[model samples]
Target: MTLPIVTAVDQAHAAPLRALIDGKAKPLGALGRLEDLAIQLGLIADGPPPTFERALLLVFAGDHGMTADGVSSYPASVTQAMVATFLAEKASANALAKAVRAELRVVDAGVDADLPAHPKLLDEKVRRGSRNAAVEPALTPEEVAEALERGVRIAREAAAEGFELLALGEMGIGNTASAALIMHRLAPAPLVECVGRGAGQDDEGLARKLAVLERAAARSAATDPLAVLAEFGGLEIAMMAGAVIGAASARIPVLVDGFIVSAAALAAIRIDPAVKDYCVFCHRSAERGHQRMLQSLEVEPFLDLGLRLGEGTGALLALPIMRAASRLLSDVASLDDVLNGRL
Candidate 1:
């Protein structure tokens, strides 16, 4: 697969951006994480006061056959159910998307059920659903390639529609299982370290989930990013990785949601390390493995309300924060301006 080239944010711009931020009409570092966020956003925009004409949250939906193995407390049907909820503007993500005035589009990546036509849903299903990873590779290399290509295309389409802020989120039953395994290989961490109580799992459920993942892990020794992804494939995750690469290639900022979405980010970062600079780890998911995912990437997330929702809900909440930080460039005044009474 030919990966997109993401040029790292020019360090040449970092110092000047920081100077501008420091010179803002406020105490040094008074903004705290907001300042850091502004700098990152500035670098992504390749200027101070990073601005995007529009923001779009791509909520990719799919199903995992592994859910049949009791990895999650919810049934696999919930993936399709949640997609409907999202389209009906009844999901938590929908409310938050509206709150931030962001457009939310639900894409069917590989949902098992044949979803009905919906104006809000984008039909980009690569397959009915990924194969059960515990028994065999969830996706062949070809399927992985197709999903990635589609993701890139989707992101490019959003960018073409004047969306500079691209956020990624996912809805897949038992997806946490897929993400944990992906992290196990990509992060090169112990399997236990990568496992988590997804969607509120009881102690017994967590153990059962871990056992199923162990079975899947033993089936592959793959450490390559794409290899691991195919082995423990979640179609939505693969597509999101492609979107991440595409966003970086376009020099746009990608606001990444929690665990499953972060797995895609990790995979994309592995494929192209430079892509990290363009990514905004938007939320700190309550999912335990999410911590390891962030630590492995050596990045800090912007918001942490102990949210474990995975439909880009956290990302929706983060959109306003991102907007405010980006506006620091044009909204706030420099100390010189304040002192000189330029305003």
Candidate 2:
């Protein structure tokens, strides 16, 4: 399937926009990254500070067949249970979204169980779960295409619904293993460096997870974006990548949540380099491989709070920072205005 065309964010207004920010009633660069964020928000909107009256956080949940390999401390059932928690507004993502005044939507990209219908749930399952990557491809090419297409569709729908910012999150048991494998494939990092204590794995469990992922990475050595995703990517990761592309296509800024989301963002960039221009790395995750992924992208995140939880919480926490950035652009008086008034 042909992906949506996403052009680079326009920097034509950079000079005037920067001047507006610099003229704000504060020391030059006193606000630091917030000022930079305002400039980027302006460029993405292609004008004045973009309206973030409504922010949408998409939590894509799926399961990985590799969970059977003992990669996670919890069972695969936790993935669906967490969806229930999200629906009940008990998950961290739900609370943070409420605190930030953003709408939280859950998508069943490829969970292995049948979930109850809910108003907040988007039932867009591509499959029950992905195939095991240690012995075979995680997904067929067709499944990967469907996940990407669904993600693009979901993101476009959110943009149409007036959500100015889209944040990406995911839930899946053993998905960290899948993410590590993808990072290993995409980055030249060692397999051990890509591995981590996913879901609080013990040292022995971590070693086992590492060995599994290392073997999987060696078996599926193709570096092509689609091929790697099919071989090592989870369903939710694939969809999030597609969503990043979709958000860029619609000219909406995307706030990527954490490590898993960052890995998906990398895949999206590999698919289309222009997608990078529209993404805001929301935070630096405490997950082991996340900083490596961020460095490979060569982008600085807005916050780093040692966040390892995945549910879009990190992105939600950064919402106030985003708003503060825009507030400076919209509310703060310019230095010239202040001086003229005094005269």
Candidate 3:
């Protein structure tokens, strides 16, 4: 199936943006990455003074069949439990989102447990959970397609509500195993090299996790993006990829979260190369394979806080920095004007 055509972020204003920044009273590029961020937001807005009046964080929660393979420290039940935490505003991402003043919404993508309805929760469950990727395909093609469409629809809905900035996040037990296998498939990295200590795995658990991922990778060696997703990705990951695509098509900047979100970004990029232009990787995850994924994308993240939490906490943490970029670009005075006694 043809993915949605995303509009490439317009770089027509790059020179003027640099001029605008350089003319500021501060030293040239003194603000460092923040300045680059300002320029990027300007580019995404296609001109000066980008407005980030409303930012929305979507946390997609799912369950992985690989959890049965002794991969994660936690059980699949934790996925639904954390969804409750998100609704209660008791999770790290909740506090972080509040601190950044961005609204957070949780989506039940494919959690195995039954989650009650809530105002803060969106019901878009594609299935009870994905199948065991180590033994079989994670999801059938039809299921994967539905999950992707769910993500695209969510993104478009957020955009329609006047949200200009978006953040992607996920919650799924054993998702790292699925992510590792997906990375192995798409990045074609050594399967062992792709494995990481997900949610605090022990040495033996990590080894077992690695073995499970290897079998999953070998079982699903498809190169096509959707095929890879169906072969090894969770419902949350597939939806996030679609959300990235939908956000790009809507010309909204997406603050990509940690390892799982970045993996989803890679899938989206594979679908449409222009998606990269619309993304700002929030941070480099402490997860082992994240740096490799970022390297493959040829993109540098905004922060490296050694964050391994996967509830969009890293992305929300970067929101203020993004806002500061816009604030400085729109409000900072030029040296020329200051010299003319207009200060």
Candidate 4:
């Protein structure tokens, strides 16, 4: 597949952004990571004046047949239910997006059940549900390719609609299991470490999840990002990876939520390393392997609310801070003006 071209973040703007940040009427680096965020937002604007004028959160939903193997404590039906809730504007992503004034868009990348037509939902289902990875490859190469194309189209459409930022979220019942496997191969971390208590797994449950993932892993030795995505069984994940590449190609910054979204970002970065430059790690998820995932990306997330939920909650929470960071560029008074009694 021909992936979209995503350029690395422009470094030419970094020095200017740093100077602007330091010139603010505050101690050097007093804002700490906020300064880093401002610089990143500025660089994403291609050295032009940065603006977080509008932001949109894209929550991609799917179902996993791997749940048949008991990898998750929850039933796959919950995926369909949550998609309905999101459409009703009552899901966590909906509330958080509203709280931060970011638009929310839910996409049905792939869910096992038939869903009612909703004006708000994007019908981009690649399949009802992925094939059980334990038995065989989850998605065919063509399915993966189509999912990616849809992702790119969705993100670019958002850009055209005038959203300045893109935030990612997911709602697949056993997606964390899929994410673990994706991270395991791409991070090259031991499978044991990548496995986590997705949606609250107990000791026995965690062990079972581990064993199930192990068997799935044994079925393939592919390390390529696209190959790994096809091997794993989550259409939402594959679509999110495409969205990441799409957002980067559009020269827009992306606020990545915890583990699952991060896994998608990982695959995206591997597909085109330049995509890394446009991603903004939102927070550290309480999910066990999230730290290693962030470590592998060499990024420090902004919040650590001990959140394990995966509806782009962390990303929405971080949006306000990013907006504030962008304001520092045009809202705050520079030291030159302050020292000259120019207020």
Clashes of each: 1, 0, 0, 0
Q: Candidate 4: where is the Cα deviation over 4 Å?
A: 48-50
lDDT of residue 70 for candidate 3: 88
Ranking by lDDT: 4, 1, 2, 3
Q: All candidates' lDDT scores?
A: 0.90, 0.89, 0.88, 0.91
Q: Spell out the clash pairs found in candidate 2.
A: none
Query: What are the per-residue Cα lDDT tens digits for candidate 3 across 1-343?
Result: 4567788866777888889899999888899888888988888878764567699999999999989988898988999889999999999999888888999999999999888989999999999999998899999999988988888889988999899889988999999888887777777677777789989999999988988887787785598988999999699999999899988888889999999998898888987899898899989899989998888888999889999989998999888888899988889999999989898
Query: How far does residue 311 in candidate 3 sit from its true spot (Å)?
Result: 0.2
How well is each residue in 1-343 modelled by candidate 1, as lDDT tens digits?
6766789988788788889889999999999998888888888877654465488999999899899899999999899889989999999988888888889999999999899999889999999999999999999999999999899888988888789789888999899999999999998689998899998899999999999999999999999999998999999999999999998998889999999999999999999999999888888998988888899999998889999988988887888888888888778999999999998
lDDT of 1: 0.90
Q: For residues 1-343, what per-residue lDDT tens digits would candidate 2 score against the true structure?
A: 9899998877778888889888877789898778888988888888876658799999999999888888888999999999999999998888889898999999999999999999999999999998889889999999999999999999999999888989899999989998888788786577788888878998899988988887788786788989999998699999999999999999998998888999899999999999988898989888898888888889999889998999999989988888777778888898888888952
- Runs with alpha carbons beyond 4 Å of true place in candidate 3: none
Query: Which one wins on lDDT?
Result: 4
